[model samples]
Target: MPLLAFWESNPDEVSQTSIEQIVAMAGDGNLRDGSLCSDELRQYLTQSDTSKLASYVEHCLSNSFAKGGQVLQDLVNELGRRLDFKVANGRYQGTVNAIGFDGIWLSPEGHTIVAEVKTTDAYRIPLDTIASYRRKLLDSAEIAEPSSILVLVGRQDTGELEAQIRGSRHAWDIRVISVDSLLKLIQLKENSDDSETGRKIRSLLTPMEFTRLDSLVDVMFTTATDVEATIIHSAAEKAETSDVITSKETSTTPSGWEFTDATVLDAKRVKAIEALAKQLGTKFIKKSRALYWDSSHETRVACSVSKRYTKGSYPYWYAYHPQWDEFLGEGSRSFFVLGCMDLNFAYAIPLDILRKNLSALNTTTTERSTYWHIHLSETSNGLIALQLPKSSRQLPLDDFRVPLDQS
Candidate 1:
């Protein structure tokens, strides 16, 4: 409860500046004494001076460390307020910091948006917990008639919430939507609307995360390259456990599954990699680009998975250089290639092997590190490979390692 602790310890700080003001001050690396934040959060906030403001919002919104009911409510309230929606119902008891029940937004489209912001994993709103909201919306026939929905800002799956609502014996009202997905959708709406008002609205949106989310959706969902990559990746998966390498006798692969750059930047692949990491009982990092890291191993390895139609030639394996640079800069030494869509396998270069090779092949280090073309086709049994079967429940981490250790 660092969040709580920080607040308690820094009553003076809390009183002097608002969270946003603190964030702004932190961005300037000027967080005064008695700041209500942990060291990690302080560091992150300080770094925000160089990063986008939206980065701060995304970090706060997504991370476990920066969350609380009040925190979530503040963010949601700001989002709704900035979206120019009227709070038909809100937990804001008006004492500036006293938060209450929840918020129901009356959108510009006359739709009532119910936002349940929860940062605690231990807390899931039960059917009974939502009765007040249901009554609030239903009792007011005028508000209920206008496309009301309970958008769950949850840390986990809200499918159960949806199912519960659907199965309830009442008016078929208040559909459920994920806050992250809904956030993206709302930003998408803002992006799609090219009107002057839309432009003005975008300019006015605070914290810059709304704009950032919109741009991310625009690129990942609407951009031409991302679309092609996603399509090719999907088709390749449906076709087979992608053979990323032909019999090219690559240095990285024994089966000649050539280590090439295939950009799998979709959400599904990311989630799959994350789930696999969870099952492996290790940490997973999927953010910003085509790189995912499995720190589950003693040595963390950055990876790019294939999901494209590469035929008998090189698959469209791509390394988002910036992502790799960031990953490596974040202290990952080894790198892995995974057939995340179909084959469910990962090949790796040991840290020593990678360092030595990158040094030898390093005609241009910094420039080359920015983008990965993975040219290690020597395959002298130096590379470590991890073969992930359909079910890895019984397989220990060692089972996937090459030179298979009997121990």
Candidate 2:
């Protein structure tokens, strides 16, 4: 029968046939010599697309096999003959009709090894699943120890064979081989065409199937292993500091200011501002609720500070009443600094001198330079400084000072 015919009929049966063929081929010394089967069926299962056997096999062979089902059947038959293994189609085991591994293996040492095979992704196989298979084999009263092996056959950029043994209790050895290797072997046999056996073995090998098998193996093993440690570490480092303030907040407002009721600030906004501040080399203070540059010449700024109503509803008139009035009306004395702005200067300027200048500006109506008004609003929670117009004359002395001209 053609290999395509068996593949189209049923995946389970196709697998069994292929295993038988491989065993025979090995026995004939056409493939490789080994005392026991190399569990190639498991590898085939991992590499084969069993969901739609006909289409998968067709795809693997690039539709070269005219009769899809027959091609698979023929391949398996040839493999069995070449490996010198007895091939059986459907073997019954109690309630289950084991299509994949119904055939009995007659070892050279007179040991009969019964095997079950599946083609699937490597990572998807759970330890529990392997345990279940072990239990099923034991329950069936098949050969002792069962000698189960899992084959993970996939492709890599470069064709190279790799193997690893896995399994906890029973210790099932796993071998990972590249599909290229199998294809190469088949190619070699085909090229020789020395005998009928050679032609049959060569006909079963296809490059496309080897490529598909490679993809399956890659996905499986890659997923099964632990990866992404570097990414995790990078993310962890960034999240360590919680209280860093940022530059955006400082740039948004004028200097030496502290905000009261800062808790009202959105968490995301605060984080963004903190990040900005770090980049700008500005100072961020949680206690003062302010962002400022370390240099005395820089201005400080703060955000939020209103005495608004609490988030929830309050009693009767209290709901309509301003929270500040309500608290004060109730004889509660609470003072909050909404926000404060301070000028940071390279040279210290006395607060007394600043106050004198402020008083002179308030009293004088004579012609003066750019006049500016610095308005500060007081709230129950804190003081808030309103933004001053550019024309407003409340310029800090530091703005007017300059070092000696270099020219």
Candidate 3:
């Protein structure tokens, strides 16, 4: 069976398998460019989550296997794609007439990086050959003059390679980083909510003079601040929408309205989202604290969790942010999924219908954000319904209840 097919059939076994074992199971056990094995492996990598990618990278670097070097090359290019770069995979074998680069990564801002992957820097690198590839690309206009070379080595101990690059003429145009650092970047980007932080992470790859430490410090500071803000917003009862951008009239939560503290409901949020994913029949990738998208980015969902209040007829309350509106707008199919009480019961409201009646909902405004308040309760007919503010008619929600079944 092909590696991907086998993985789908035997996820637990494949999850415990090493890179060598996986390669052995793949078609022909060969990973040359354009081969069936290579195609299957790359497809498998793309479909796998970030954590799986990190594990595969570790296996490739730690164990020796047939065609391991070529596998590492493909892994590095996949890392490039995860970093939001437009990646073009280079050939497995270099020919005299052809450029021998491992990959070409194009940034959104038009900068180019010719990437090379090496398991070790113990042997002296041919800086001239790597530079020549860049030159050829520049001459053919395949890459612009602002292009540079990046060498991703397997080990963090690159003292020998560092000295070699410093002494070489290509030192100004070449930068070296360990695969470990690259994986951390992927993890960081996946966890972060700020898009600017992603831009800064990409900037670290661009060839630059690091003699002055200000730019590096700025990147660190920005990343730390954004991560801290995300944590605070997730935990705060009346939190600012730190990840959102808004410009609107400030309002306050209505008196007697219930507030769902995120900290109290966070544990249930994960299972709720998982249930919603199953209901929608899509594998969703986390984008922020409450936002997710499918692999194709075609479907988006913002899931909120609330504890059921004992005192009120409308027992559940959830805050809906403008940021979620913007997020859902980008998707062809979007939903605001609300999990109440034990979370066995939930409503997946269509964004279009919810958006049309947003004006009828009450608002809670903090210094940094203004969000709508959603209330849910059981009607006299024992059906789920959305209780609108200002005595507006309760909207029937029975049609939108998401089934929380293992099936």
Using TM-score as the measure, which candidate wins?
3
lDDT of 2 by residue, 201-306 (tens): 3223211134457644643333332123222322322232222233334212253232222233334224433443333344332211122112221323222211
lDDT of 3: 0.78
By lDDT, the best candidate is 3
Residue range 246-346, candidate 1, lDDT tens digits: 33322243533333333233443445444444344444443223444432213344545554344532333333234444444555444443433333434
Q: How much is the lDDT of residue 69 in candidate 1?
A: 40
Query: Where does candidate 3 clash, by residue pair?
Result: none
For lDDT, candidate 1 versus 3, the one ahead is: 3
The superposed Cα distance between candidate 1 and the true structure at residue 118, in angstroms, equals: 2.2
Which regions of candidate 3 are displaced past 4 Å?
Answer: 238-282, 286-291, 300-328, 331-341, 345-398
| Model 2 local distance difference test score | 0.30
Q: Where does candidate 3 have its weakest 10-residue lDDT segment?
A: 241-250
Instruction: Write the number of the candidate with greater TM-score, choosing between 1 and 3.
Output: 3
Instruction: Give per-model TM-scores.
Output: 0.33, 0.24, 0.80
Candidate RMSDs in Å, in order, are 17.2, 31.1, 6.6
